[model samples]
Target chain A: MDERERSEMETRARLVAAYDAMSPSAEVTDRVLARLRDDARVPEKKRKSVEPDSRSALRFGLFLLPLAACVVAAAILLRPSAMMPTATKVSQEEVVVEETVDAASSDAAVAGDASVEVAEEAEGLAPQATKSEAAEADAAAGAESREPLCELYPIVVTPEGRELRVGDVYAGKFDDVRPEESVAFSEDGKRSVACELIERDGALFVRYGDSADWRFAS
Target chain B: MAIDLEAVFRRHFATVYRLCYSYLGSASDAEDAAQSVFLKLLNHPREFADSEHEKAWLIVCASNHCKDELKSARRTRVVSMGERLDASLGATDHLDETIDAVLKLPPKYKDCVYLYYYEGYKTAEVADMLGIPASTVRNRLRKARALLKDSLGGS
Candidate 1:
C-alpha cells in the first residue's frame, strides 16, 4: 500500500482498538431486563379481542371507561351517514391486524406473553387490581392509529340520556399519537382523543382527556 | 423469530454501545442510549428476516435515538469515560489524537467510517447494514478517508 493507503490503515487500526477498549457496564443485560419488567407493569397492550367471559370483559372494561362518552357522542352525530366510513376504517384496521399477527406471531416476539402470564397469576391471587397495575394483552400490532384502550369500558347511555360514564378515560400517551375519532373537540390537540361527552341539562359538552383539561364544545 | 433477549443483547450490545458512544461521546450516555434501543425492541418487536436485518434495525434505531437525544433540550455533552479509561490503561500516545479526529467527522461520515473501517465491514456490507446505496457508502467512506488523511498527516 502507498503512503495514503498506509495512513488510512493505521487510522482504522487505531480507531478499532479504541472502540475495542470500551465495554458497557456489566449490568447492562440486567438493567435492560429490569426496565422491561417495570414497563410491563403498565402493560402497554390491548387484548386480542373482547373475550366472551365476564371476568375478561370486566377486566377489559376498566380501560374502555374513558372512551365511552366520546364514542356515544360520535355515534349520535354519525349514525346512518357515518356508518359506511366507520365500517371502512374497521376493514382497514382488520388488514393491519392481519399483517401484524403474521409478523408478530410468526416472527419471534418479545417479552409480552410471559408478562401476561405473570399478570394472570397476579389477577387470580388478588381478585382486584388498580387500573394501572392491571395486566392487559397487546394486539393490533402494526397499526399506529389503533387504541388498545378499548372499547374497554362502560359507555352505557341510559334511556333518559344521563350518566354517560363520566370520568376515568385512559387513552394512553403513545409516542406516535394517531387519534381514532377526532371531534370538533381540541383539548390540548389530541385527535380522536379520550374525553367525557356529557349530556348536561339538554345540551352536550365534551371533556378531553387521558390528560389535559375539560374542553367544552356544544 | 424467537426473541431470546440475552442472546440478542450479547450479539448487538457492543455495536450499539460503540455507536452510541461515538455519537454521545460519553460512556454513561452511550450505555443509556444502548439500553433505550433494546427497550424499544422489546416494546415494538418486529420480524427480522435474519441476523443482518436485526443488526441493521439496531443501527438505525440507535442512530435515531442518539439524534433525538442530541436535539433534546436537556442534552449535555460530557467527555468519554471510555477514552479516559483507555488513557489511564496506557493506550499508545497517538490514540487520543486519532480518536479526537475520528470523533470530529460529521455524524453520517462517522457511522460510515466506523462501520467500514473500525468495525471492518466492506463498503457493500456497510451499505447493506446502513440501508444506504453502496455508492453512497463508498462516497461517504471516500470523504471520510480524505478527512482522516488530512488530519493524520497523509495525502
Candidate 2:
C-alpha cells in the first residue's frame, strides 16, 4: 500500500479500538436480569377459574329456571302496553332519570312535593285508606322534620315513559343520594305505588337488593 | 437445544452497546438502547442459523433501534455532543482525535464507518445490517473516510 493508504488504515484501526472499549457498567446487566426474574415469577396471563362442565351448566340453569320464570313474568307484567292502564295515576306523574337532566326537570314539575304528590298519587290505587293515611302521616312527619328530602326516580324506565312497578327491584346507580333515605318502591294491594324507605349509611344509601360501586354524577 | 440468553448477552452486549453509542452520541441513551434490544430478545427469543447469523441479527436489531431512537423528538431535544470515550482509551491523543473525528461525521456516514472499520463488517454486510444498498454503504464509507482524512490532516 502507498503512504496515504497505510496512514488511513492506521487511523481506522485506532477508531475501532476506541469504540471497542466502550461498554456499559456491569450494574445495568444485573438490574435487567433481576427485572426479568421478577417478570418470570409472575404469570404473564391471568389465571382463570376452571369452567363448569356441561352437566354443571345444565344443573345451574335448572336451579335458576324458577327465578328466570319470575323475572320473565315480572317483565311481562311491567311491559308498557297501550291497552294496559297504570294502576297508580296522579293528576301529574313525571318520570325522572338522572342522566337526562331535561327529563328530571320536566318530571320534577309533576313529582316535586314528596308529601303532597306521593300521598295524592298513592291515594288513587292504595288498597286501604289506612295505608294512605299511614304514608301521609310519614309524609307529614317529614313535612315537619328538618332532614333533607331527596327525590329518587328510577334511572331505568319503560319505553312508554313510566316508572318501575312498586314490587320491581331496581339495579342501578344513584347520584347525590343517601342509602338510608333511599327507598325500594312497591305497590299496595290497591295497586298504588308506595316506597318502603329504610335507613342505611346514616340514611345516606337506600338498599336496593345489594350495594354496588355507583358511578356518581360528575 | 434451546438458545442460552445469558451467553448471548455476554458475547454481544459490548458490540450492541457500542453500535448504539455510535448512533446515539449519549452513553446513557446507548445503554438504554442496548438494554432494550436485549429485552426484545428475552420477550421473543429468535432462532438463528449460526453464530454469524446471531451476531448479524444483533447488529441489525441494534442499528434499527438506534435509527428509531435518533428519529424521536427526545433524541432531537437532547443531542449528545460527542462520544463518551472510555477513560483509559481517552488518555491517548491519537485514538481520541480519530474517534472524535469519526463521531463528528453525519449519522449516515458515521454508522457505515463504525460497522465497516470498528465492528469489522464488510461493505455489503454493513448494507445488509442497515437495510441499505451496498453501493450506498460504499458511498457513505468513501465520504466518511475522505471527511476523516481531511479532518485528521491527511492521516
Candidate 3:
C-alpha cells in the first residue's frame, strides 16, 4: 500500500505520549526475577522434556524419509524384474533346456535339440557329402548353438493387491520358445497353468491359460 | 555465558509491557503477560545472534502472549485508557481516544500500529521484528489506519 504515513497527527502524538508514560511496575519486575531465580535450579534437560514442540518430531520424520525410500527401492531391485538383460551366451550342449516344437506357427521356441546330434555327426569324420554340403551343415549347427536368454515377470491382480514375482527364467530366442509354464499367485499354485510363448514382430510374448490375454515378456 | 538477565530485564521490561498494554489495554493484565514472556526467556534460554535478535524474540513472544491473553476466556471486553493514563496524559482527549481506538483494533493490526507509531520503526523493520513479510506489515498498517480513521479524523 502506497498510503501516506499519518505521523504528525495529534492522535499519533497522543498515543506515543500515552504509551511512553507506561512502564512495567517495580512490583512486576521483582516478582519476575524472584520467579526466575526460584526455578533456575532445574536442569535444562529436565526443562526441555516438560515443554515438547513439533520441530523435533518434524526433523526426525524428514531424516527417516530418504532411508525409507532406499529400503523400498532395494527390496524392489532385488527382484529379477529390475535386473538388466545380460548378454552371456550359453553353448547349445551346455544348456539343459527340454525343447519341443509344438503349435509350430504360434509357439516361439528355440528347439535346438538337433544341435548335439549335428555336432556329433560333423565330428564323426564320415564321408557323407560334398564340401558345399558340409558348409551348409556347419552353418545350421552354428545357428542352433547360440540362443539368447530371456526372463519374465508376470503379475496377477489379487484380492489383497498387485504382486510382482519372478515367473521363471527361460533360455530361448525370439524365433521359438517352448517351456512348461507354471505360476502361483499366492502360496497355493492354483493360478499355475499351461502357457505358450508367441513371437510377433520380433518380440517374445506369452499366453497363460486359454482365457489369459497374450502378454509381452518384461 | 548465559545472557545477563538483570540488564535484559531492565532494558526490555518497558517495551514488552508497552506492547502488551497496547493489545490488552489493561495495566495489571499487561504486567502478567509481560512477566510470562520474560519467564519463558529465563526458562528456555536461547543463543542470540545479537541484541536485535534478543529484542526481536522478546517482542514477538510478548505479542503472541498478549494475543493469547486476549483470546483466553478470562478476558472480556477490552478495557479503555481509563483514569490512570488519562491523568498521566493530563486529560489529553485525542491521545486517550486514539489509544482506546488502537486497543479496539484486532491484535494483528494493533501490532503494526504500535510498532510503527510509538516505536518509530519503518514498515520493513516492523516486519523483520514481527517475523512477517514487509508487504504484510504494510497491509496490516493500512487496515489499522483505516480502523483508527474514525477517531484520528481523516488525518
Scored by lDDT, the top model is 3
**For this target, which candidate reaches the highest DockQ against the unseen true structure?**
3
Per-residue lDDT tens digits of candidate 2, residues B1-155? 12487778778887888878777766777777887777667666788898778888888888788888777543455453343664434447776666667667777686788778887889888888778999999888878878887877876
lDDT per residue (tens digit) for residues A1-218 in model 3: 23343454655676677677565556766876665555465676664443235645655776888999999879966867347432221122122112211222112224545555544544432232333343443443452442322233254332344443444333224321233223322112333333445554455555432212445554
- Per-residue alpha-carbon lDDT of model 2 for A59-129, expressed as tens digits? 57778988999998788668665235633321112111111223323444576744455434433432223
Model 2, residue pairs in steric clash? A127-A190, A166-A186, A178-A204, A178-A205, A179-A204, A179-A205, A179-A206, A180-A200, A180-A203, A180-A205
- For residue A97, model 1's alpha carbon misses the true position, in angstroms, by 80
| Alpha-carbon lDDT, every model | 0.58, 0.58, 0.60
Please tell me what DockQ candidate 3 reaches: 0.26
Better of 2 and 3 by TM-score: 2
Local accuracy of candidate 1 as per-residue lDDT tens digits, B119-145: 678988888877889999999988887
Top-down TM-score ranking? 2, 1, 3
